[model samples]
Target: MKPFTKLVILLLSITFFVSCGNADDDVNFRLNTGDGLGKGKEVDECLNLGENDLILSIQEQFTTLPGKVSILFKVSDSDQNPISGLTADQFTIYEQGRNDDCFNTISTSESLARISPNSQVFSNNTLLVLDLSNSVLSSSLTELKSASISFIDNVMPDTAQESFKMAIYWFDGENELHLLNDLTISKEELTMAINGITDDISNDPSTDLYGAVIKSTDRATELLNASTQGDKIGAASVVLFTDGTDQASRFTKDAAQKKVDEADPNISFFTIGLGGEIDTQVLTDIGKTFSVFAANKEELETTFNEISTRVSERANSFYLFEYCSPKRDGSGENNLAIQVKAGSKQGAVQTKFDATGFTGGCE
Candidate 1:
């Protein structure tokens, strides 16, 4: 696609999440194809206000302001290796600053992540970045395919599996980064997409992983931020699989990482390196705040299984910490020492330090 044309697609895709159009239009601008488009809207024919009714426009609006909180944690077992597979049942959750008038009350005192009792309205879609750089790697992609099938079968809740989709994109081919929509929800279709995976090294047509990651993450942000059915949407992590480094990307690693962090503060990232030439350190650092793995298969099967476990539990429970100041102008240097303890574990992140900027009424 031409650069200008691709830009148009990118902007159109971003429209799914961004609040656009006003009362006159029926649809909100930012939309997530993965999350499904909004159904039709009810027109407010009566512009006049009544005791219980007010005629407003159709476009969506952002009513909530950004909540500020810093979270930090350290994962360790008795032997000090980061452990996985524990469910929400195994931990305790807590919040500080209850002494001040901010939130209603402390939910718990143990500092574990609070699992919402409500049915999850979110989707955890994984966009698989398959590697097809060489013939041997192409064969290995089949193993990856088998692993992918097993992943869907084991990890996803049966009812939501159709909603929890996966997209396939292979590097170094005629259409190297195209989304395999047929494979998005079907194991059979995924198999077909993988079966046809091949490596392309032509000069006129090329592969650029940086561009792909940027594009994928941009798409993901839209999916997460979209609102449907009068509620906002959410997503888990992006699991990336690649056998090689960024050989032809338009953007640098720093730029991509910054973009991701800005888009969604809570979205986790994970990666899988399929072969020997993969950059283990780069992948590890890329997901430094979240999770990352790059390995060859003497132990990769085990790695993938562990990846499944992490994602499953994370989908069930997420940690949210909130800290706030007292009313409008009541200011004293608000310094807090907060800690989250799970079993015998202890973690503390520096909350906002001395500040005096809130001149208006606190929420």
Candidate 2:
């Protein structure tokens, strides 16, 4: 081969290898910016601690004038099961400035970092819908009431907070979704409402399961819209319990499913079915988030408790993590990463925030 041709071929090979190397680096350290409340971008510059057993998804983040940085995020395991009751002590903050090659560890104690209440920026609402048809009212009303009270006890916090609230609604053959109790933070009020349910409460013998699903989804959408009107982020759950299929035929199954499908993404649907008469497939579709079944009334409370546990975990997963940034006004934008350690598992997420006006009076 000619000398010039040999040199050209060698140059092309080197260029191709270099391009492949850059592509591999991009893939290895790719960053993901999630959507909605879990909104954050991963930082490629930060060190990878290890295989993440836990996933920290940032919902929202902001900065205060006096150098306080606030980040709201949800924690879940690799299986997507939420991890709750995590304290600020479990978190470690790292910040990277323009001059730093990587993140610098920030002292949690020195930064006055803490996990604050999310009431100012986050809200979670739950709508518990019950079936009061003839079958349920006559045969399983007592068991249903007991299970519902257990659900309330398990889901509600010991102390009430404005950010967490629940409302109760019941349905029968009638087209209306009757309100058993308005939204309240008091678990006692919810339990009392459940206990007040009597066999005579439903005059109709038919069941409007589809109607109830539609109405409850509408109510949940309204609540989400109201909660998110300002700067707050909101989430809701619709937990519906029924012992049988829809009998009234007032609404089509497709309509109910469509309502659930088109509802706000922030709203989650959970359904509980009891006895052999219920259709598991339909309930599973409606309860896209989760669905539980009980072979008979004997297992009702346990099934309700399972759903309550999930609801509570989901609500508690959101953390309002705040800390005083060491960055000054001229620092421009800095890379921030939060690592959380829970038992044997750990995970981290990274994002950027401006410290253009940051100062030193954080509380």
Q: Backbone clashes per model, in order?
A: 14, 3
lDDT score at residue 77, model 1, on the 0-100 scale: 30
Question: Can you give the lDDT of residue 92 in candidate 2?
Answer: 95
Candidate 1, run of 10 with poorest lDDT:
54-63
Weakest lDDT window of 10 consecutive positions for candidate 2: 28-37
Candidate 2 structure quality by residue, lDDT tens digits, 57-90: 8878999988999998888887667789999899
lDDT of 1 by residue, 1-363 (tens): 899999999998778556444522533222221111122122122211112111111111111112222222223333223333334444322222325543222233322233332233435555555544553354465566666656555556555453355666555533345665432556556656655654442322334555666666776665556522335345546666666677666668887666655556335666766567667777675554344453555445565666666666555432222333232223434433333335555433223333335443323
Native-referenced Cα lDDT, model 1: 0.46
- Local distance difference test, per candidate? 0.46, 0.90
Model 1: CA > 4 A from native:
1-120, 135-139, 161-163, 173-176, 182-207, 227-229, 289-295, 318-363
Cα-based lDDT at residue 3, candidate 2: 100
Candidate 1's displacement at residue 340, Å, is: 12
RMSD of each: 17.8, 8.5
